[model samples]
Target chain A: SQQGEEDPQALSIQEGENATMNCSYKTSINNLQWYRQNSGRGLVHLILIRSNEREKHSGRLRVTLDTSKKSSSLLITASRAADTASYFCATDEAGYSTLTFGKGTMLLVSP
Target chain B: GAGVSQSPSNKVTEKGKDVELRCDPISGHTALYWYRQRLGQGLEFLIYFQGNSAPDKSGLPSDRFSAERTGESVSTLTIQRTQQEDSAVYLCASSHRAASSYEQYFGPGTRLTVT
Candidate 1:
């Protein structure tokens, strides 16, 4: 069973605009991590928010977690063309070493 | 300080023929994982190897899929009697250690085309 499900199957926005994607999981998680894939290949780790954390930020990326709702969101401020890619949320269900990934949200940053 | 590496980058094999994909994780990383992505879908966890602790094979789809790791170094994912449905990008990732709090470094996936 998939643990995480990301909302907004796809998004299109012009450069300099902000994009937000949400993910909801079914199980309690140890941590939730966001990853980006370019050209449908390798995935680059973006940021991870532990169960105890409410929010986190790295560069242009911001993430917020709400355990009560079993959901999380990823916000990309000041988006750029290079940020066009598929973004996925992965969860470690109940402290499991393995991760379960959501279907992902495809973001298109048009310049 | 090289990142995770995978080979031969792309592979094409006939149905029923076996295939092998290799992954070399970052030096000293003790946790490695294998995943399969079909087209635009998300990653499907395949297998995981963490140090000497017995690997977690709960995610493998079937007996046709199997993986092995040598200590904390190289790992191999083998698919026997491949099917066209097996066509997908095989990705490998490694983290510094166990537990999900650590970030995982990924390799440039191997695109497999089973015809």
Candidate 2:
């Protein structure tokens, strides 16, 4: 069973536009991490936000975590056609080492 | 200096045949993990290993699946008498430490197909 669920299974936007994806989980977590995967390739870690933190930023990516709402969002600014990929959120529950991942949101950035 | 690496980028075998998938973690990385992803689905946790200590095999789906890591470097996942349901992309990942939270570096997974 997957612990996290991402909304908007697919999204499309023009290059240079911003894209946002949301994820919701059912259990309490110690930290949440986001990853990007190109077609038929392994995942690349984007950013990680701890439960105590409200927001985190890395490169052109911004992530927000709201423990109260059991949700998180990832924002990619100045998107490029190269940014077309699937995004996933993995959650590490409190007292657990294994991270559970969401189904993922597929983003298509057009040139 | 390289990231995690898995061998046999692709594998195809008939049903009831046993198969082995190998993964070599980055040098000095103590934590290694394996995941399975079916088409149109998210990655599913399969197993976790920290150094040569006991591995967390709770996520394995059945008794036919087993894994072994030697000297904290290369790891092997073996599926015995595989079934068609066992077909999936098997991914390997490694992390520096298991301090509760750390980013896992993934390898290009081995695509397994059981006929």
Candidate 3:
């Protein structure tokens, strides 16, 4: 079974708007990472936030991790049509390198 | 290639037949992993390889599913007596340092269809 679950399975937004997705996990984790998948393509790493950190930012991407609540959120600012893809959150528990992925959130950006 | 690559971008096979999926990790990468993503589902970890040590096969669903890697380079996933339920996109990934750097590079994946 998957450990993480993302809310709002699908989201549609216009270009230049901000997109936010949330993920919640069932167990404790060492770190959580976000990935973007293009249609029928491989996944690309976006950002990783460790358990000790509360928030992180990479360019237009912002990720927040709340270990106490076992939830995390990814925010993409100034979305573009090229940003339309499925986003997934993966968790790695302590001493466990194997990643447990969530169902994912499909984001569609319209021009 | 500069990134991970998988062979036979798409594969179609009949039920009860065996199929093999291959993955070629980036050069000098020590950790390799395999995952399966069914339609409308999350990616499931299948197996992992770290250098020359024993592989972690905890994620393999059954005995019929097995994977092997040679010298931290190429790896193969084999499924025996395939079933319709086994149809899914099989993905492979490799990390330069499994314990330290958590970044993993993924392959395009092989879309396997069992009839």
Score residue A50 of candidate 1 by CA lDDT.
92
TM-score of 3: 0.97
DockQ of each: 0.89, 0.74, 0.69
Which whole-number lDDT from 0 to 100 does residue B12 have in model 2? Answer: 99
Name the candidate that leads on lDDT.
1
lDDT of 1 at B30: 95
Interface RMSD of 2: 1.2
What candidate 3 keeps of the native contacts, as a fraction, is 0.62
- Error (Å) of candidate 2 at residue B93 is 0.3
Candidate 2 lDDT over A5-111, as tens digits, reads: 88889999999999999999988999999999888569999999999999999989999999999999999999999999999999987989888988899999999
Cα lDDT tens digits for candidate 3, A1-111:
778899779999999999999999988888899999998568999999999999999999999999989999999999999999999999986778788889999999999
For candidate 3, give the docking quality class from DockQ.
medium
| Cα-based TM-score, every candidate | 0.98, 0.98, 0.97
- Clash pairs of candidate 3? none
Interface RMSD score of candidate 3: 1.6
- Writing each residue's lDDT as its tens digit, candidate 3 over B11-112 gives 999999999999999999999999999997789999999999999999999999999999878999999999999999999999986762388899999999
- Inter-residue clash pairs, candidate 2: none
